[model samples]
Target: MTKESLKELILTLEKIQLVLIQEGEQEWVYGISSIKRRLTDINIDSPDFKKEFKSVQLSYLNMTNGAGSFSDVMIWRSNVEDRIKVNKDFNALTKKTWELFEL
Candidate 1:
């Protein structure tokens, strides 16, 4: 993907994180699934992307288990934080990957 596309993806991810924080875990399910779909569309072969995407997917699955308790909220928050961190790392990696093509 182009750098602009990668930046857009990261921006979308940050928006999702904000939605999760404001609207709760139930609202986050759709956002996470959408992100997973976007990841699939990129079709990149990087192990880091796959690994980070898997982490986000698993955390999303755990958050959507219908528990609906305080602990579940905490877990969901933690998962969102993890996703944000992973997305930041992925953004950096994507920039570097694209830079290599310019050389």
Candidate 2:
């Protein structure tokens, strides 16, 4: 990905983080949807980064579908853990992706 695209992705991830913190689990579907859409727009060439991104996406997808209510999707402990892991993984991947930018 180009530096500009990487920067955009970082911004998107930051937005996701904010949404997760302020809105909590119920609103995460929106953030995840935004992240997925943003991911599709970037050209990711690294296999490792692609894998990491996919991991985060899949985790969110599973959590989003685990419960009937999008607002209370994390009613279970496992679901809550999955969301935490997804956030952590996305944050790490975002940092790694940022390091690849030239300037």
Candidate 3:
């Protein structure tokens, strides 16, 4: 991908990320659902999925309220989301936790 193409793709990914996050937060669905949907759309099951995911990794800094260092919020959050995708047992644990919470 040319630099311009990469920039465009990154912008698209950012939009996808935002939409996924909003859907997850608004509907109380797991964010991973949106992530999965978006990833799949980008041919995430293809042989190049892993490479593509890593190539366009996003990063940003954020500050909350008074007097704090600029924290790497977007990267941290993405890493967490990525972790939830990577850890094979996380979904099962999340389901069980939700079930217990609902009970």
Ranking by lDDT: 2, 1, 3
TM-score winner, 2 or 3 = 2
As a whole number from 0 to 100, the lDDT of residue 20 in candidate 1 is: 51
Tell me the TM-score of each prediction against the true structure. Answer: 0.29, 0.33, 0.26
Clashes of each: 0, 0, 0
Error of 3 at 99 (Å): 39
Which residue ranges in model 3 land beyond 4 Å of their true spot? 25-103
Per-residue C-alpha lDDT of model 3 across residues 26-83, encoded as one tens digit per residue: 3323333443344436553468765655432321111112343222122223577675
Residue by residue across 1-103, what tens digits does model 1's lDDT show?
Answer: 4556555655655555554556455655565556545554553556466565555545544544567722233322258878677556545543442242221
Question: Looking at candidate 3, what is the lDDT of residue 40?
Answer: 39
lDDT of each: 0.50, 0.53, 0.38
lDDT tens digits, residues 10-86, model 2?
A: 66656555555564554564655666565656556665676656655555455445456332433223587777876
**Candidate 1 error regions (>4 Å):** 1-9, 19-45, 69-103
Quote the lDDT for 31 in model 3.
Answer: 37
Candidate 3 residue 52 C-alpha distance from true site, Å = 8.5
